[model samples]
Target: MDLDVFVTAHRAEWDRLEQLLGRGRRLTGAEADELVALYQRASTHLSLIQSSTPDAVLTGRLTQLVARARATVTGTRRAGWRDAARFFTSAFPAAVYLSRRWWIPTAVLSTLLGVLIGWWVAMNPEVQASIAAPEELRAMTEPGGGYEAYYSSHPAASFAAQVWTNNAQAAAVCLVAGAFLGLPVLWILFLNMANLGVGLGLMASAGRLDVFLGLILPHGLLELTAVFVAAGTGLRLGWTVIDPGPRTRRAALAEQGRAALGMAVGLAAVLFVSGLIEGFVTPSGLPTWARIAIGVAAEAVFLAYVYVLGGRAARAGEVGDVEAADRTASLPTAA
Candidate 1:
């Protein structure tokens, strides 16, 4: 086809696509997702065409339509925020239920209980030396006492580096493990529980419980809980993928992933705060009560942010309840 004719033809087709997308604005749930995807594809094609021709004319009608499409996308996103707000408003009862629900509690308690059983396995004398021994202690501990040797050779900077690196690795693990979604999340929670139990056991055995408390209580609870939240999300996502219950795995996973990601995002922030506390504050020998106080204060802040403020977004109620209910009906169940 001739160049001008081809351009005109393509523009006309694009215009129709945009109109359909505009009509899609009134759609809800899965239809909405489909419309967004379609619009995305059209945008990509437009980009390709624009890139291929430096002097391409911007047809007045097409330009106006693109602007309208962009406005529509913006409106959709704003509406999404409103829907999330409505979710929290309506779901507060659900969150409270999850907090008090027997099944959710049972799942967590059972996981913790299993970790207590594995405490012995992880604390095997051999395992103890590898994980507990500071590798940097080779110089200070006279070839045997790694902890002494480790900190002596390196100033606190090394410890800071190690802590930061480990925390980052844990965060990444929390994220990547979610690929399995919830099962992997369960594994992470178990791993964290075991680590907590073993570390506490070792500290008690050495009678350095105060040192441990000063070091861990300041940040341990928040960090561990955050990790658990991330794991929970991943697990939920994976479970949706596996069972999907009534909905197809794709639909279930998308909804579960949204809720899970929201929770995980909050948890990631906790991870950083915990890292900072562990890195700078804990090692400084802050008083035990001080550590505990700081820990409690942090907990309060997190609670307020998540439950009090974050739950009640400004955009609440913009999304229709009927539509939200439809999405919820198809959405995978997760506490």
Candidate 2:
């Protein structure tokens, strides 16, 4: 098995493959057929050399050439509507259902924290003073003041767009920061809850707790749920780094990270709905019950989607990651 003789014999085939690949989508029918034939031959040649020889330079060059030829032959696939449909129906929900253990507790604890902090701020004058001057606080919570006006300050469409963008960015941060031991995710949740608490306390202190609930509940229900899902998924991702169980840490993180990203995109859509409710319904002339009812219905629909569709998908072994064919192969590692 003289490597020189093998190289001379296969050089022309390799050169032809390179030429076909470099043509950039203008191949004739005959050329395309030749490209496929060349790719198969190169693959066989690569396998033989890999098994029979140890020439690093030749092997590396052949490997790269084979990969390029293969790509040219198969081409890249563009995502279409079907991919989008599959994501929402299966991947997104499965991720939510799978991370229920993390996000559910996140929702509970964050709500409790906001309620407690709100109560404390309302009951204690010192806390109120620390948050803002009395006049400033009054200006914010007073009827026809900052709190109510904030929603209508901008046009409904603009407000909804702003809210969607902001919430999506926050969700992206949670998903990205999950790898940092989830500390940033927790911090983001805390900051959000703390702000909620302050708003609640200000409203309660001004004897406008009912108004606050009326305005917030309609959108907050679904809005906060999406945030909790993001945070919870992020925390779960971080924990994977700490305890990957039966899988290696890298594998676990990779899997959860992909799932977390899917959740981010899904949650963006959820937040968009919530944003619309906040922008239009909350500030509308509709009765309080009607507004809150709209919010509740949306939240209910989302929950059912997660529980029914997501549950079924997860049970069927969907983990919200990319399709198996798209995943990269990992090297064998000890468990």
Candidate 3:
């Protein structure tokens, strides 16, 4: 193929495509159709040039032109603050609300297990001794000891940031690792509960159970709720692998995986708030009742957000996934 001849033949079409692209949303139906046609023709021309003559300069121009035309023909959906707002109000809450069945039971069972473990440790000296030496236990549970000092050990802002990062990472891992059939999520929950149990047991043995509650409840309520949501969503993802219901296995996994990822972003925000409570409110000099009330109020508001905004969005068909327009078109499957 003669390079000049090929360029001359397709140059008018390429110019038209560029003109349409420059119009940017001002194209009529005819121009839009023409742009797509010209784009296809230019693509063919570029292929021929590359495979035959292999002219670097001509190939470069066509490459950029085809890219711009493709962008114009396909259009882009850039996310802005509006998308963020919709996610928090609709997608995030709807996901949490939908997965409540899994997480609620998880929360109850885990709490019971923690309490049981605490009781065993408090009542049995062997259990306590097995956990830690007697002197270490006393230092942890005694007044103004390690357990209470843990909160005030760092600056509030830095502590909150650190807590948020750690919790967010945990939630993300739960959501992602759920693909491995949820075993990891359960183990993470068990470790969390076991740690809590150890704390409760030590404090109770020292008659400082009330102090533990005072320190923990302010942030633990919301913190644990976020973890449970993540764990439940992850368990649901794993179960989807086992039983995809009406959808194909791939389709079901894709849908749930997308929702789980979105839930991660939302859960990060929830954890941030809990971190603030833990860092500032938990360590503050306020009365225990006031601190607990703040935590309770935050948790209540979150639940209402899920039940109200999330329910409304779910009823309207939001499923915590990306907008329909943004999703890849799935191949049709036979029933």
Candidate 2 per-residue C-alpha lDDT over 1-335 given as tens digits, one digit per residue, 9 for 90 to 100: 89999999999999988888887568899998998899878877876676566589987887788777766766778889988999999999999998999999999999999999999999999999998888998889989899999989999999999999999999999988999999999999999999999899989988999999999999999999999999999999888988997765656787888888888889999999999999999999999999999999999999999999999999999989998755533434456
Can you give the TM-score per candidate against the true fold?
0.55, 0.80, 0.80
Best by lDDT: 2
- The CA root-mean-square deviation of candidate 2, after full C-alpha superposition on the true structure, stands at 5.7
Name model 2 segments beyond 4 Å from true: 1-75, 331-335
Compose the digit string of candidate 3's lDDT tens values, residues 137-246: 88888888999999999999999999999999999999998999999999999999999998898899899999999999999999999999999999999999998887
Report lDDT per candidate. Answer: 0.53, 0.89, 0.89
Residue 86 error, candidate 1, Å: 13
In model 3, what lDDT does residue 20 have? 80
Give the clash count for model 2.
0
CA lDDT, candidate 1, residue 62: 42
Cα lDDT over the full model 1: 0.53
